[model samples]
Target: MTNEQVIRSFFETVRSGKDPDQAPHYMANEVLAHQINGENRVTVHRTPQNYADHVREMIDAFGTFQLTVEEVISQDPKVYVRWQQRGTHIGEYEGYAPTGKEIIELASAVYRLEECKIVEYWIQIDRLGILEQLKRNQM
Candidate 1:
């Protein structure tokens, strides 16, 4: 798939509040995404099912989070994405009750694709923004 197509599908899957299964057309069955930005951490999932819990966690916390792609520059198998994430805290998040706060964060993700399927992604987003909205000063 072209870089544009792959990125488009990512947003669609999350926005639809659906599982990766909904977009098998975009993955290699063993898709891997790395949390390199928001979490400032790196983890890899070998299979789509491997990320089921994380997916639920994300959709649950943000409660309608959307990754809006702003700029994308690709050079085969690798693409850098500049995006904004917007969502509302509507449920239990970080062991806290629904704060009913909406958060917007700027972020970037470097996607690694194999055979047109995104095998891995390195993402970064502003966690402090959400924390501030929750009225908890971040360290």
Candidate 2:
């Protein structure tokens, strides 16, 4: 599969709440995951199983969210993707109690692939926007 195809499949299978167990097929044994929110950046090392668990956590909070790939651009070893995710807040997330509110999140990531497996990624998501939605009724 091409780099773009790998990223698309990763989103479809692992992130779209379809089947997160397929993470091993797309990610390397040790992957570097960078989370960027404005000026704050943090890096975490992940195995395929760990990545799968992360997706499971997301499912726990969002409850079978729908992810739509908005754009994809690829060069050689790098692929960039923009996606929009929509779901209901059915479980606790980031200290926020579930409010049964519909949440829409926009995220983008640039993934670096080795062979056909994802080796590293830098991602940004609209987490603050989701927090704002969660804070609406509390305030």
Candidate 3:
């Protein structure tokens, strides 16, 4: 599969709220993920198994979710994706208890692929907006 296709399938698997059965096919043995939220930033290097576990944790936190791909642009080893994610806050996130509020968040990611496997990625999402929604629901 192409890099774009791999990304689409990866998101689709996460959106389905099921354990990813094909994750190993799309992700490299070692992947570097850079995530930033508000003033906090984190970077994790994960094996395919570790990444799968991380994805599962996210799915569990978000509950049922949908990812709408707004754009996918690819040039050789680099691919960029812009997407919007909609879901209900049904599980704990970042030390905040679930508020059962619906959220719509936009995010973009850049991925570097080698031999159709994703090796590195940088992802940024609307973290502040999501937190605001959760805080509003708490009141």
RMSD of each: 3.4, 1.1, 2.0
Candidate order by lDDT, highest to lowest?
A: 2, 3, 1
Models 1 onward score TM values of 0.76, 0.95, 0.87
Q: How many clashing pairs per prediction, in order?
A: 3, 0, 0
So what's the TM-score on candidate 3? Answer: 0.87
Best by TM-score: 2
By TM-score, rank the candidates, best first.
2, 3, 1
Against the true structure, candidate 1 reaches a TM-score of 0.76
- Tens-place lDDT per residue, model 3, 1-139, is 8777877787677434455656787788888988965688889897778777776776677776777889989887888989887778788887778888787888898999998888998889988887888788778
Query: What do the candidate models score in CA lDDT, each in turn?
Result: 0.68, 0.90, 0.79
Identify the runs in model 3 with alpha carbons over 4 angstroms from their true place: 14-19, 36-41
lDDT (C-alpha) at residue 18 in model 3: 55
Better of 1 and 2 by lDDT: 2
Per lDDT, the best of the predicted structures is 2
Model 1 spans with C-alpha error above 4 angstroms: 15-20, 37-40, 136-139
